[model samples]
Target: MTTDFGLKETGYIAPSFAEILDGVEDDYRTRLGDDIALTSNAYLGIFARLMSDASYDLIQQQEQIYYSGFYSTAVNSALDRLAGNISLTRKVDAPSHAEVVITTEGEYLIQAGEKFETEDGLVFDLTEDVITSKQSDGAFQGTGNVECEETGEFTNVPANTITLFANPDEDFISVTNPRPAGGGQDYEDDETFRKRLIMENAARPGPTEPGIKSALMNLNGVKQVGFIDNDKYKTDEYGNPECSVHIYVLGGNDDEIAKTLIDKCAAGITLAGSIVKEAPDATGKLKEVKFDHAQQHNIYVKIDVSINDDWNSDAGVDDIKQAICDEINSLEMGQRVNFTRLYSVTYDVNGVDDATIAIGSTKDKLADQNISIGRSEFAHCDPGDVEVDLIGL
Candidate 1:
């Protein structure tokens, strides 16, 4: 009977031709007193070698076929679909936009497609043309919104940095971004994608907490989401009863979020924040629907680290500070900032031996506990806010 190489037991070893030949020779020796010559020139030796090579090739082919079945993309994709698992795909890029205030010597007509650049070579294009009129100071001023040509986190661009105009003819116009650009993001990574899949699969159908969270998470750039059942809260300005769902979202389009709430929530469910959208009834008349959104509160973090004597000098103290800042920056909205986690990050550093961390204040390290942000609040730690003191011992 032929052995099934693919069905072999765990840790099973396929017998090589050489090993089989040895067994055959041993049987021949026992039966015929070692009369056969096992030289390479002999027919027996040549036949045994050829059979051995064929056996090795057969085993390799069987192994390939066995492993290929497990890793086949088509099979995995089909299985994932059957299990209602979402496949990984590239996330859309979000653009960064800022409002630019254009100042001119006299009444100047700025075209809609006018371009400006930052010192770091990031170009921005005007969304609309503006005719600047003379201001109280006798200088022509008009506000035009600009969007970054390339998308990805332009929130760090400082105010008054956009001074270079692409058109020399518009040299008289002085342009500056009054506020930092925001709403830019990169593609989602594998881990984040997998987590989303898990969340989606686990969510039950309806306007439940998990379902609402899952729906909001499907939107691009949504880092965190919180749902507050405000049945007991004060009534709205319009004198409507306060049985509303207050959605506190971190990172995502406000309009889209509001729409999602309208779709997923039950009819007559009052949404808390003001998100106005036009809806058409069966009569073809357009009616406006207003939903409420939660406000944002920023939470600050403060940390101090101590380094060991054997710390690497090349890995500057600034690196440690930046590392701590990065940890805080990676936190999701409304997530608590655990002091022990910060301590763990400091200890994980190559040179750091110990650390003392405070969320809101420096001297209040022991008394002040982990920061617990409200549903409407998000935790943010500026690099400037993170103060690191390296105590070398």
Candidate 2:
């Protein structure tokens, strides 16, 4: 017996306006005979061109909907409504913030709400006023914190760069940021928002572990989250029940994290440590409640990468270093930094032929040990902590 195998059609070539016009003209010519002047008449040609253009546009629009339903605004809007997610085009922008330290001289009273600027024109406003006190040595010193005026990644100004005070004279006051600003981000891209919506849909029923993790991940500026069940911590220091969640966050307000925890966590479960809260006393005066954050532990990642001769450029070396830092920063609490994965990422870089990574040793392979974090601590890796060396240059 002979059997026939059917193959599916896999290619489509959309007809252009000219192709459609030619086909219509040819059909008209066939029906009316070649003696008729199909192209010479201005009115007939105009009508054919108009019909062809309309048909081509309609086909193109239909093809867009057929190929990617989400590409259609109406379709995407309907899906977002069903998924209970905001449209990717309308996602909120996250603001960047930094702590600006203002130093003044000669007992000057730097007023609250004072503004400072970087040479490149990034603005920062004072959160509170400060009084510079002159010591017996005749030197004045004071410090105050400031926040960036705009919401953007560029607002994360460097230390000592915000020296020009917008108000008052720059001669009397000096501005500096002890740490880099963080948390500023643009609205979510289509792919990221789509993935988030899918995760949300899969976890929408109730508060399962995956749901909680998804919720936390969806929060702005939260990079990674690690959850420890009751079994992980048998008891607290005082013999109380202890369950912990570790979060590695990049930007957004710290206070917002507390609020998110309260909203997402189950009742009667402790947040492992103290958290800041505001409450009113019997006198109706607001009182501040403070809690300690999870302790941070730093891990040093040392990578030596071998680059091909053609790719032994500064940009290639920088890309390798940046990749290592991004991987380390993406780690959550209690997550281990696998040396194998790190090595793979290094080799995956465009110009990296091979790489040898050591956690903290000059040796090629330091037993391939991975860094582990505790329940009460999150792993942190400073860009400075990541050491990358270019070899075979």
Candidate 3:
């Protein structure tokens, strides 16, 4: 073979592009002459800048390509499935399961009022006087029935003549209808106002029974309420009812009712997007949204879920367990059902050899329309101690 320089002169030297550029690195004198090299290297500077910029852009594109794997189409699918499942439904007289978040202290407001009853079984307020009439002197003469000053009972009524008496000082009153006075009707006191609030603002307490906190919370504009035991009572220097019963009332734009709730419950409260604020619904608007961006992001993914249990052991019916899981997962808020922990027990019928098995069989017989199995723990509980365990998230 000829010498490398001799072959290059003949144009027969093999060179990779990188090698060619490398060979030109030290030939600035030949390419630009001694005078040009001594002046400035602006052209080289421009080329270097361009190369660096292009390299940086390429790196950024590569990074995006790498992390795209995390944004999976399956995640989007799961989200859609989850969103669709969570919804609200209204029933004529059906019940539902719901969670009650206590935002403030609530004490039952006890009001003492009298219920006046007439001899004829007619009822009226003890505070108001009534007019009794008889065919006196062939004219409709009005006979005034004086209400008792102390007992709020009417006295001096003719025997056998209908007379009204106060039923007694009762703790509660049904104010479904307000008395009509002068031109219109209006609630005169805080007690009357509270009842109106309950009618207009209080929502159904869901599937659970009305607990102290929940019942008061259901009052209109009321954020929350409940009783405080002596041990838990906040104290001053000397332990007294230092803590005035706390009552949360929402007030704000007033247009959006939920926003009002956020305003009143400044502490011991939580407020967020509809997912956290929306009431539980079985058929109404789902509180979540789901979408897939894989085409835009170029990502792929996979997810697997499995259910397994000892069908022979008889812990809980597989069907009920499955239903519980499905219902829980379907919720939009994901905070609706309390399933973080589960407790269960088994029993044995003295006459029947396997009572635990019999209970499991009964659970299996239930219909499995919308069902899911949630995370559950097992324990050896005393027989007949198996109560439905409700654990909150």
Highest-lDDT candidate: 1
Query: lDDT tens digits, residues 52-125, model 2?
Result: 78878876776555444342232444445544543223245665555665556566777878887888988877
Model 1 residue 40 lDDT score:
73
Which 10 successive residues of model 2 have the least lDDT summed? 1-10
Candidate 2 whole-model C-alpha lDDT, 0 to 1 = 0.60
Query: For candidate 1, lDDT tens digit of each residue in 1-393?
Result: 133344556733466556656665565556657787766788876765566577777876665455433323223333334234343343557666667889887888888888888988888889898888888888889988787788765433556787888876643658898645544566655455556665676884347778878877776556677766766567755444577766666665544555566556666776654446565544566544554333344444555666666677777565666666777667766667676677776677786766776666342443347767655666665666666666653
The backbone clash count of each candidate, in order, is 5, 1, 20
lDDT per prediction? 0.63, 0.60, 0.27
* C-alpha RMSD of each candidate structure in angstroms: 7.9, 8.4, 28.0
TM-score of 3: 0.15
Report the C-alpha displacement of residue 329, candidate 2, in angstroms.
2.7
Clashing pairs for predicted structure model 1, backbone only:
272-292, 273-291, 273-292, 273-293, 274-292
Per residue, candidate 3 scores C-alpha lDDT tens digits across 1-393 of 111222234432343333333344335546656563322256763453455455445544544444333222112233233223332111111111111111111222222233434354434333323222234343222212222222211221222332333443232222211111111111123333333233333343332223223333333222222222223335533222343222221111112223323333323322222122332223453232111100011111111112233323354433334433343323321122222222121221111112111112133332212123111111111223222321220
Give the Å shift of residue 199 in candidate 2.
3.0
Q: Evaluated with TM-score, which candidate comes out highest?
A: 1
Off by over 4 Å in 3: 1-241, 246-345, 348-393
